[model samples]
Target: MRSFLLLSGLFCSLLSFAQTDTLPVFPETPPLLEDVLQDAEEEVDFDFDTYYEPLEALREHPLDLNRADREQLQEIRLLNDLQIEAFLEYRATAGPLLALYELQVIPGFDLPTIRRLLPYVSLRSSLDDFHVPLPRMLSAGKNELYLRWSRTLESSRGFLLAGDTSVSGRFLGDPNKWYTRFKHSYENRLSYGFTAEKDAGEEFFRGSNPQGFDFYSAHLFARNLSRTVKAVALGDFTASFGQGLILYSGFGYGKSAATMEVKRSGRVLRPFTSVNEASFYRGAAATLAFGPLEATVLGSYRRRDGNVVVSTDTTETQDLPAITLSSILNSGLHRTPAEIADEGAFHQLTFGGCLRYSSDRFAFGLNGVLDRLDQPISRTPQPYNRFYFNGNQLWNGSLDYTYRLKNLLFFGETAVDPNGRLATLNGLLAGLDRKVDVSLLQRWYSHEFQSLNGFPFAETNGVNNEAGVYLGAEIRPASRWRLNAYYDLYRHPWLRFRTDAPSRGRDWLVRLTYYQKRKLEVYLQVRRESKEQNATDYFGPLDRLVAHQTLQARL
Candidate 1:
């Protein structure tokens, strides 16, 4: 009965709070690394950059500081958001916190964010999800097994037509590129695993993968459960709300050197152990809590591998000839025969939901998503895709926010596309003193903003025809001297892909360091960028239109 009237209105709002008020015990978020999902696969065009399975699941699950949260303290990108709200307002006005030298008297806690939370937080004590024992959480905690294999020592004519048994340019498989993983965890409540991969000219267990790793993933994550179902997932998952537009299947990091890490922290639901086969979302997702309102729900059905385009125009009452989908084969490589005839052709069904309301410094969220596709998406006729997105369905809606006062802080997200186009992202992180810090960001996507799982916080890498402005800074002044910088200015009005007009860009970064106290360190860095392209199609005599500049160095 509607989850029993939402658990009897969450037990009458937990009997109107005050059962000696207590809440804010979070921890159990580990599994992220590839320099942290490499800026959302930097506009994916990969040739290779392995993501060692979430750094072996954070080297076997780590992240616990009086149970962390704030998206696991913003994935230790080295505290921002005013030093994670001065270490949670100094552990909620003094209580629980014994050493780490009481964060040298909080207030924008520094010392390089306590030396990056001393290798993933601790000061333990916060493990009691009441009588855990799923066979002692599966024989007391951790277990891992991973394997990798690769090939490509030059020999591609489809691996020489797979040993040439004729069939010109053959290649129905075999070139070796396999990976396997198995994980098991406990102490964050529990997690299950499985992952397998193969893609080096596909074919593994024979012709077009006769069931033998052509990509496979599995998962089971649980947390708190009966404590008001605070988390749950079964079989591949990922979800992100806010600052990511509608649904954001995690992956981030941009303009690095940890300058406020350009916000977009996740964990509205997680566990999709990356192998990036068209960015996770296999099935089921959940999170529920009513003490400060939090409710997340998700559903997914996968089968996405592209290429199925047909359109010769004619359909005003069947005369056949109108099937679409041209583009979307996210390199899950399927070894030639025209990429094994487009692998899993296309079938995606997603439905997501979120509604949040956090406390202690405010927060709010409302996200929605819907995507259905089973052959229908015609593209090929451009002027920068004249407002893309065709048939087979797409829907998105969002409204996100966060706030703080006292050394200031704020965050934002706004999305819409019921075919009315819109996208927005906002930020500010100030704390200018106690050494210094500053950050500000603004984004406005909308060249017909569309999202089939957004990734907001951009400079192109997919978040839709850009519009940007960002500024950042950090300075230590002493105490092992430090400095950081950032700058971004962008525009991409339309035409993309080998650009041909409507473009503008700029990027800058600087880092300088010199630490000592955990055994010396030194650093120096620089970067530069500029864009607006499409040059050298070999035409000079009075030719025109071109621009480029890229540079980076360190010492």
Candidate 2:
């Protein structure tokens, strides 16, 4: 036991010595805190002037073709204001310049000036180079392509319930949908493909078609036009006319059919309201721009076929021809010689108007024929007048002013027999006349028509008096931000057809949006609506409120 203890002590001593030998050996030295502090102080006093002076001098020096605003570019050696303005304007409309050589494209920016400016100008910054190359190359032969996809969910509720039926009971609605777009471009031209949409909501209304996968739009065009005019032609397409006054054929308005159902004593009481097929118009259209004066003319034909009753009822077919013309005139005071030379902007008081005419088959009006074959019916073809106007005609005119202060824009219009609530007209004729036929109007009606037409029944005509004013102002405080807003008021002379009674309402909408970067955006909106009537036993008070928040990104 004694011998073993001696051996253990020797082994412990050997381990300690080995551990000590493994450690690093160094000379003893004092801390250098003083030296470090001195070095930091020297750095604090170093001359930033060496870096800032060059930048200041560069800023003070006027830029030539590549790095200058209109005025500064004009001051450079041989260039004039007109040439400078033209160059800057072109650049502004085009985009961030990619190379100094592009300056030669500007009028009066000759090769010599471009060469002189090259040393002082840079097409890219260090940060810009760090990002992915723009006009991203997609393939060796094909131009770069960009694709985007988005999804949204929305819910809405309305204020009034007209009957004890399901649609009249609660106004709860939800829609979930997705969208995808693909685009490819070369030079000044582009080609695009789009689709991707879905609908999920209550059965009473048709949500958007799952399209599930329908090609919504596929087209190719040159966005930048040749010298005097701009134009586009479509092979097969959809379009809108003058705020949709005459024709508006697009997808998804009536994806869901509005319906009403009632049940009593555990038995189905009433069948669903008639399900009207969604409307789609196939056509081609274009706009012509001579200058400040522009015009758009469109013509389209549509057909709708559907059953009035169950599978046994015979189908009804209808055809419609729609046409519209819109024109704008502007004074030529500030126009360039090219504008005046081109005979585009004429020197005259500014005015404009639009005319839209549609044959009867164009719109979806209420069908009076009942599905029961044995029932008695009136045979007057339900007064089939394609043009249902409470007043005289279907023409609209407006007077406009373009002032020098930021080229302020002011316009007002009045329409004769404004077709729907969408039309805006000007003048004393814009008021509603109580004696006019209240039965032919489609959108908003006075209480008299509602009572006369009966609950849950759809009618075309109503009170036609509608007048409103629109004023707009746009100001950009920064390069990446803008603001705009508008207000509208509408009035009906008769409240529920009470002679000498009037009801009025107002709608307000405001929006603000910000472009945080080239591909990112954020926006906020507020909307409010109010009606002039108090609650009646038949219908609730009329009022509505809505608010929206949105963020969008593109890549």
Candidate 3:
């Protein structure tokens, strides 16, 4: 166990520079993204797809700092809400920034923050004419294509099996996974890309999916036109707004070394090309801006694979057939006949829209979404399942806002389901001084609160049957030394998959890092978490419930 934790920490630390080669001028990805994804992968597992479309897009199309608003500034990830507010205020009163180095004078920006942000941001005059001619946009665009394949040496059972056509037989293809992408862009104003991937256990050219790959995605996005259209997407894309209580299609960092990583930031419409097979819009989405106000509308039709059972016993009594599902099976693996049988068994339609208004220090947004399924959903019999969405059609609408006061930035969202069950998430991000920063998030999702596609910042996976509080801080006492820590206390009001009764849990992480120069860094991290789960019978005299404890340190 000691060696396992030590090796786990080293493995993650070594992956820090992995994304540098993905683009022409890709700098070593800031460690903030690497650590955030590592924790998110451990939390949600398969949902943490290593999609680089957005980051690559940003690097190729750097944000012009002088013209960027609160939303555009937030996309930098290195800028917290407090820093964003300060940046806009500085530009408003002092006029356009004379140089990029002016960031050193910003209230909340530290040296490390400035270094991390320099790659994706630029300082340009407001009248620099950021627009591109349509002919040059199409004729002078840059294009890149990438193909990658990977496999494991020690394989799972699906890789080696006796030759048989039975349902229990091995996977149709080898254990190797395949990925390929093609992208075209012109200074971030115009972009079109195609991405495709096959999971490890899925077939290559046989069985249910005869195509070369199990998944394929294509998108074309153009932004910043004359004055009417802010953006447009012909195909697949993702959207995130406010603090992500209503719609956060893009993945944001959770708990990480950067204490203020709590804020979620991305354009309203972004190209989506992750390995996660669900939760993305497939048809069309667009954003239109008119001065201080902006509007967005989107609609999608996609097929998802899940096991579904129609109950005949209740069919005669109701107009719709009762459906039950064990899980959504997000692994994207189709090895055996049982797995293949679940492919595209359920069809769905998702449509939503958002209206946003932005001022110098305040922003307000309204978002609404509707999800319809060909088959109704019924979860396994559990206390937590009582409030889960049941009907084939579901809808959620929310109002989200952000307001700034001095060094503190306050943000929150209030959402409701079709029946009025409510979910609320509120947070505060403040820069105590030049050397310290802190963040607080409190979430309350009613027992019956649900949104089929709503993903918020919380301890649980989604906004349903869970409530929690999170607090985090980052301290820099010197130019080269920094400390980060956070504590999360949460409770599941109803039973979950592994636990038989309601439970409470807590998690905490602390990390220290030192840098001699921008080129050299050394870091140490310690983490501990406690949660309740079903216990084994090995420990005599104990109840069926056990508190799972984990402690790890990396130096």
Candidate 4:
């Protein structure tokens, strides 16, 4: 009996090893005999109902139509690539879809496909409300069309005319200035639109010079990919390079110096003549990102021709190229507030530069600029002198620090320009003509900031010695409000011409703002300045006050 039992055990062991190697392995031991038998029975009971249950659940909980992409839409098994493309193109041209039957109009979409997709599409306005529903008047695939028209009326005081007329005029505001725009988008990814404006005002008048349609901007663009890359073009657009040292092009509208005047004894006294010039720069810019590194490059050319002085034509043409590179770290030697408490810190270091070459067919100059920003210090400096001197003769550097104190943000920067002497030399050179000798007319022509002739009445060259510290804070008391305050202490040793006098000055600015939904914002600011003068033979005080209010709205 014992021999027979041993032989039987050996046979069973061989059978178990064979089963383990040949079949899928579960745990160390197989399920109980009863459970295994029951599982087998369940597999035999499988039918179409079991498969359709999950499919029905997924269809009832389909993805949001507003944000769904082609892949997600295809997962429903009712749409294909061609159908998706047609739908996207149609929606882009027609606007938001309002009915799912509209999909039948798209190529490749048929009755069977629409019936299969009916349970998974919705026409709700809110993305969160998107859910399976029966067909209704408003369906997900039907496009909606909307049209809008607007007009603006603005009056200007103290407006300056480009002719021989004096700096005084009050004319009727532009009455027929109208704006029209058309936009159509589907799934928020595919979109296209066009906008145009027309104005009938005195400026557009021919013989009598009535402002009518002085300027207009029109553009048409479509977004190919919304998440990663986007493309845009404008007939007349504006952009800046680096810090505006190399390139800055756009339409600028502000108080023109010629139009701005001071009221003395009820008489308007103009400080400086003003010129209004408007033009457009056509260009392209893009940003690329890979892991912790990012790069941005842009290039553009602009042509501006307008009135500078009465009767004298001024035109300038310029080309600019700019690039920037940055590296980010999440831990180790460089750390930021985001990584400080989690055994590491996130930091970023960036280096960027731009160059601009300007020419007017007769004169040309090349301007180059460089900037560097490392952890704890973000430096930004423009090499204006390099462009004027035609070499790398000027350098500016800065060190900045940012520290997070619980819920507070504290930051400061210390900047220095070692090549200030070169700037001073340039100012002196500008005061002299090509003959290298100072001209009497040039003396008076030199402004207060650029004069270096060592005028006996004032120390005109002293502004070259400039060094200062800026300390400010951003305080948030409410979710929609903020306060900013800053103090500046600047010392100019060159401003001190006589002994036993203070040469330092102090200035401060405080601003308060209220923001709501990033759409509406208002701010109030105040500034005060005090300085002593020894070169001008005047020492006590000079102060100025300015205040203004502005408003903006977008739909």
CA displacement after TM-score superposition, residue 252 of candidate 4 (Å): 14
Best by lDDT: 3
What are the TM-scores, per candidate, against the unseen true structure? 0.33, 0.33, 0.88, 0.31
Residue-by-residue lDDT tens digits, candidate 4, 1-555? 111111111101112211221211121111112222332312421112212322333443444455555435643434433345456556766877767667766644544345556666765555332232323211231122222223333332422232324423423233333333333223322223333333323333443223433333333222223223333333323333321222233211111110100000100000000111122233444333243222334333332221111223334642332212112221121011122222211112112222222121111122222322212211123231211211212333322222322222222222234443222111010111111111010011111122111111111222234444434444445556655454545555432333223255665555566766526656665656555544443345632222222222211
The TM-score measured for candidate 2 stands at 0.33
Off by over 4 Å in 4: 1-202, 205-212, 220-280, 305-467, 474-484, 490-505, 509-527, 530-555
Ranking by lDDT: 3, 1, 4, 2
Question: How badly does each model clash, as a count of residue pairs?
Answer: 2, 18, 0, 23
Off by over 4 Å in 3: 1-25, 41-62, 126-135, 162-169, 310-327, 538-543
What is the C-alpha local distance difference test score of each model?
0.71, 0.27, 0.74, 0.30
**Model 3 TM-score on a 0 to 1 scale:** 0.88
- What alpha-carbon RMSD in Å does predicted model 1 have with respect to the real structure? 22.3
Clashes of 4: 23
lDDT of 2 by residue, 255-297 (tens): 0000000000010011101111122222333444454344444
Model 1 misplacement above 4 A: 1-98, 102-109, 112-127, 130-231, 234-248, 256-282, 285-299, 302-318, 326-373, 376-378, 381-477, 485-507, 511-528, 532-545, 548-555
Write model 1 residue lDDT over 1-555, tens digit each, in one string: 111111111101111111222221222322123223332324543322122333223433456566676766764455656788877777777877777678867766656557645655667676556566566665555555556665666666767767666664667776667676666666456668787888767778867677887888989887765667878898898888887776776566666666676777656887776688887788898998888998988999988888887777886797888767876777677777776677788889998898899898888888889999988877787777767677788888888988987677888888898877888889888877778888889898888777767877787766788888999888888878778888888889888876766888898878788878668667787878888787877476643447688877766
Model 2 poorest 10 in a row by lDDT: 255-264
